[model samples]
Target: MEPSYILHTKLKELVGVHCNLAAPLHFLGIPFYRFAENTLQEICIKRGLDQKKLLLHLQESQKQTVVPSYQSLSKSSVDVVINHLKSTHMWFIRYRLPFISQMIQDIDSQLFNSPEIAEDMKIIFPEFMEEFIHHIYEEEDTLFEYIRKLYKAKQEGFMNSTELFYLMKRNSIKVYAQQHQDDDDEMAGIRYLTNHYQLPAHASPYMKVIYSELKKFEEELMLHSCIENEILFPKAKALEKAVVLKLTQASKLN
Candidate 1:
């Protein structure tokens, strides 16, 4: 059977409403290392009947270009970003993995009778476990490290948002509007993954419930990423550059 357009529409809406880049990459249908590239490949492969169809379908998804918001704040303030990160990314790491781990056990128990489902579950389960370890590292090594550096820099009165933006811009960092894969796009890939290229059937109450829950969580993660990547980050970059300019001028006067 063909994929449900309704689910796809609802999932797309979720991405439009909820995604934040501050969220963990894994929760956003990406792992930290090679997330963008690998995830794109994974989703496309998972959903498509074969490699060629997957690639072609992925190529057609819309791309977002962030336009900075006018709201002023410190570039490195970390408040909004942290809030988003905690709610979307950290929460998943801290909580969802354990629940999913339990679910995997349940799937394991059922595997003997349902070999195909069991095998698919096994494939993704171990991959996700390994991915989780890397997720932790990204938080500690990359995301948190950056946050700490930003905090220290802020404390030392080094620069504000505007200044930071300009500095990164001058350095050709390309920090803003980084053209992240959209959350809906990623979630579609995930639906492809979790459902194993097929929709949950009206077969049993158990299958239906599990399928529903997974879809819900996947949708939530995707939406969260969309908000951050498409809306929040662009605005943050602009604010950073603007504030940084003000700070630089103040320094010059001293």
Candidate 2:
């Protein structure tokens, strides 16, 4: 859609035609239930978002065919990788998970007459969500924190032998990467439960939206894991090695 047309179109009309816009709009903090009547321009103005950038994101969401490459990011500094990972973590926690949970609840309320699917979702999704959130917390609190310290050590050199020894004793990036399992099994359970997300012949529009969004979420999760395992961990391990090498040289000099 043209930028001018998108700016002028009612969000309801736009989203009706492009249901894929729903998650991106939610990520941009535009709740469709509340702002469907507004034009994109109006929402942008009210939300203080750049209309051009918002339009571009929406358009890209529609047209994007491949997962974005993280090859360049693999060469980026540990701080850059950490920041990108943290932003993805925030998006999952603050936007995607809640939106999916709410959608499940909506489906449950509407599907009480035929509650099997909804009941399965209610039982399964929350368990997956809880584990996912805990994983995020552990990364931020332990793994990311350790990486940051390695970065600091590289930048400042170790303050003392004890500081260096303490960091060396901590779990290394290699260990974390080895222990990290992608969401393949968890998402497989969801896909299996939803019967490969094949919509029933009589599935409602809302049901279709939930299934579509869940599939997208699964893709995003896979990409997130790839970035962490392939890019973040390698860079961090290199950083750790550099810090250790510098400390070793200093000790030899002493």
Candidate 3:
């Protein structure tokens, strides 16, 4: 749909034309089902979101043909990258995870003939979900919080001697980046259990939806890891070095 048409189109109509719009709508904090009766412009106004930018995001989300890139975001400020990452986490936690969990619960075990697959779904997937949530918490509380501190230190030029000393002795972004590993293996067990999400020929619709969403979730996880490890981490390391250098020069002057 053209941007002009989409702006005026009711969300339900737009979603009918592009079913994939549902995910991006949810990600943008727009509940399509609740606002199905409203036009995109109305929803934007109600939500106080910039309509043009929201339209651009929706259009980009519809490009199923291309792999979305965060390369440009690497050039963004540390807070900008961190904020985007936090939003991604919110989407995962608030929408995607719950959606998948409910679908998993709704699956008819009898359809799976294989007890092993059922057991894996009941046990392994839930465990993985718990671990994944914990990982997000750890990053937010530890890694991301530390990065914010580094950014502040850089921005303020390490003026506070006590704060500078505290930061210098605290966990450095360089150290964290060196130790950080992309959790590609986090979903490895589940992927192996599901045979890479290959559903049986006789798989029911519910089972199909589960596998499809799971595959998409795994892909999103890989992209999230790439952004953190490749983009955010490198820039953070540079920021840390700059702050430390400023502190050293200040010490020399003192």
Candidate 4:
């Protein structure tokens, strides 16, 4: 909305939550992307209505929903970061991945006509999903637990452990990251089969569900990846560096 346009952060704080309101706001004939640069009043004027009405709607709708607050996680504690990753891993494995695979299969098998296209579409979706799930499990079993241990050791006191032992177990963050194997290149297969997941104009309910769920899965994953690769990884590395430095200093004094 322009002169009165609110930044999303301000809107989130004013409205008391963080979320993606692009779809609903767009339906109101508001230019969703304008949200990046314009404020709410700018949008209201375009709709030829008072900005107050627009604000009211956004506030009312936004008030009820509670979403994850990533802002707080910018410099969050290790346990909080690990818990977020674990929660994200569980969601992908237990819900999002399975739901998308099933929806794609059900829609392709029942509604689509071409056998070759259907089979290709069916295979690619789950292949992409399963590979990503395996990657998540590896991190859960190894990297996340390693960070948790390091954090615990830091809290307990670096001097608590023997110098020889701590140095032996010590690793650069780069080494841990080198173990983070993620290749989503195969996911291009799903996109190719779905023609970039574009639905036909007269798409049925199931077709709509398939596209919508797939889109949500990607969005959730990008957010998940951002936390893991950006916020959590850097912070963990800093934490590790600080701990190692403390231990190294202690050893020199000894």
TM per prediction:
0.50, 0.74, 0.72, 0.65
Candidate 3 lDDT, 164-215, residue by residue in tens: 7786687777667665664546889989989999877766444555677789
lDDT of 3: 0.76
Shift in Å, residue 93, candidate 2: 1.0
In angstroms, how far off is 203's CA in candidate 4? 2.6
Query: What does the lDDT come to for candidate 2?
Result: 0.78
lDDT of each: 0.45, 0.78, 0.76, 0.62
Per-residue lDDT of 148-167 in model 4, one digit per residue for the tens? 77787778764464753554
The total number of steric clashes, by the backbone 3 Å criterion, in model 2 comes to 0
Error of 3 at 111 (Å): 2.3
Off by more than 4 A, model 1: 1-78, 108-114, 132-173, 176-179, 182-190, 194-202, 247-254
Ranking by lDDT: 2, 3, 4, 1
**Candidate with best lDDT:** 2
Which of the numbered candidates is closest to the native, going by highest TM-score? 2
State residue 78's C-alpha deviation in candidate 1, in Å: 5.2
Pick by lDDT: 2 or 3, better one: 2
lDDT-better candidate, 2 vs 4: 2
lDDT of 2 by residue, 1-254 (tens): 67898889887676666667777787777756457689989877887889878877887777755533587676678898888889889988998899988767655445433367778888899988999899889879999999888888778765676687676786777778877854335688889888888887766545666788898898888888888877887788888888788878878988
* Model 1 TM-score, all chains together: 0.50
Candidate scoring better on TM-score of 1 and 4: 4
lDDT of 1 by residue, 26-103 (tens): 344432222322333344446553544433443333244342232332243555554555556665666565545444
